[model samples]
Target: MPAPTEMPTKHSTPYPTWEQFQQMEKRQDALEKRQDTTDRRLDSGAGEFAEIKKAQDTLRQQQAAHGQTVAEVREILAELRELVESFGNLKGTIRVMRIAGDVIRWGCTLGAAALGLWVAFRSLGGGL
Candidate 1:
């Protein structure tokens, strides 16, 4: 009779050693530790996200307030422009009045000089 050969069954691993089981358990433990670290990092990220949202809100409010201030400044500039235009018109009117005053003063000076010269000539000619 021939010696019976050991046959591998379809559903069985011939043999898994004790060391292999221990290695698998150690790998599982390491994986669990890595998962815990990842979870902690994700929790910290959520807190950072909340802080970023708060900062964004603060910036939005400041932008809104600045817009209102800009509008007010524009209004003030418009009023200042109108005042400057009025001042220009008033300056032109004052210049016209100054010219009229100078013309009257010169006319009076010439008339007085002419009258004085006529009187001097008449007195000298024996028509005192």
Candidate 2:
């Protein structure tokens, strides 16, 4: 009987040669270098992002403090408005008091003059 022939495989080469293996190693090294560069860039970007977040937090705190200060200022303004209104009312009251004082002084002066006239006439015997 004849010896059995070997069956043909799908690919032409069964395994990679020395030069092909060397080329694959070089490609893998390049890929690793690129990955390292990407990792370093991502790390630096993360630090920048953290710094930006911290700054935003500080700004928010400052804004809150300013809001409280504004509220306090508004309260002070309201109190000042009430004080001014009270002063205006006091001015009107003082005017009314001054007018009343003038009227009382005039009434007293007229009464005293009339009494003096009556006494003089009685002493002079002017009545029949």
lDDT of 2 by residue, 14-87 (tens): 57678888999999999999999999999999999999999999999999999999999999999999999999
Residue 80 alpha-carbon offset, candidate 2, angstroms: 1.4
What candidate 1 gets wrong by more than 4 Å, as runs, is: 1-20, 100-128
Q: Show model 2 residue runs off by greater than 4 Å.
A: 1-11, 108-128
Highest lDDT against the true fold, candidate: 2
lDDT of 1 at 26: 97
What's the TM for model 1? 0.63
